[model samples]
Target: MAKKCLGVREDTGDPCKRPAGSRSDFCFAHRPQEGNEKILNLQHDPYHCPDDGQKLWYVPRLKLHRCGMCDGVLLNEKEIDPLVLESVLGLSKVAEEGLAVECPTCSTDSDLSDGKFALSNFAMEWGFAVQKSKYHSVYYCGVSNVGHCKVCGSTWFAGPGERDALGKNVGKERGFWRVQPGGSKIWGPLDMQQRLREERLRLVARKTEKRERMREKLCQHVDSNGERCNRRKTQKEGSEYCFKHRPK
Candidate 1:
């Protein structure tokens, strides 16, 4: 069921240790596998978060950067824009293009390590929640909240439709929840910028196409003569032509 332990050593029959992993004995600890599960277990696990205590058992739904001391999570999905998180981290205010940043809390690079941490897999463990949502950044929001830390935004709408036990639905989507970097738990999943962007693009394209059609119709009404045009301003102009198209 658990699949052969994968640790059996043919030479000694005692779980062998791989040169790269300190957890080959039983996988109780591991390094960032480079291409696999981010097992948050070792005394110095790299994926250890330092924000809230969500490691070894909890991982942020989405993160862009992390703390190497307490295992805090940051969101940095490609879906998110950069200036967003930068603004939250006090790195920038113009959310036009995302830039490489450094956490005001830590010195980790904000690009590849933007949404991950590696410092809580040592001794302590805590239960918590994560919003897993993002705006311009995988770490914070851009349109809804004022900042990124969750110490002041932890509430709930109960279900997907914002319903509580009383059977009353608010019909609004509340944010997600998670602990702040150094404070109490909070509510988030603040924004879905990628989805927002896609929606915006679709709307613009549709409007542009409609505008092009209107221009074509107006131009066709002129025919070859630029004078008064072929079409008349009569109520039946839809069927009439401009002055050039009139019964020449």
Candidate 2:
């Protein structure tokens, strides 16, 4: 394991986790209070420190800067752009509001806007049997919506029925499905479909093998001076004799 600073941070009230100095037992900041000043120098190359060869962590256009190793300024000539900084930091209200919707089951928040996967409302309509009343139900599935929660392993789906905008069902069979928490599903639709098909094929193969094994142990009785009887006429399990030949 790499060595870590044994000193505690004064500002955060936490242990200082920075690497300890090579020559000293403590980190640069925690070295004996005497002559503990930081050394800042120019880099021989752009965006990198010459003394330590560590890349500087800084946004040239936003004036947000930090040194990776030596705590020194590598580049400071670029002008600051507030708009660019805002875009980089994603400070807009739109971005904040997009993550407002939280999963009902897991209470985990998700971003709706700029979301690669999202839950969409789907409605199916049907006519009442004896009347002209229009009926419809809304459904949300994991395959359709990216609403599967990683924290609680919950899949939120609304069944067909009267529901509010919040996806609460208020009508007949009107409710949501809270799937039991289990392993996460990371497979794509095609992969899941292929897996299901493979499982079905395996089950069929097992059944076929069981039937063949049953046929192999059937009654082997032969008639008077004749050929073997091919019928599996035994009534009891694992019995080699047919019902007619077995002892009463």
- TM-score, per-candidate, Cα-based: 0.21, 0.19
**RMSD for each model, in Å, please?**
19.4, 23.9
Q: Which portions of model 1 miss their true places by more than 4 Å?
A: 1-191, 221-247
What tens-digit string does per-residue lDDT give for candidate 1 at 17-87?
A: 54433433243332223323322222234322332333222232332233323223444234133443332
* Best candidate, lDDT: 2
Cα lDDT for residue 23, model 1?
Answer: 33
How does candidate 2 score on lDDT? 0.35
lDDT of 1 at 69: 30
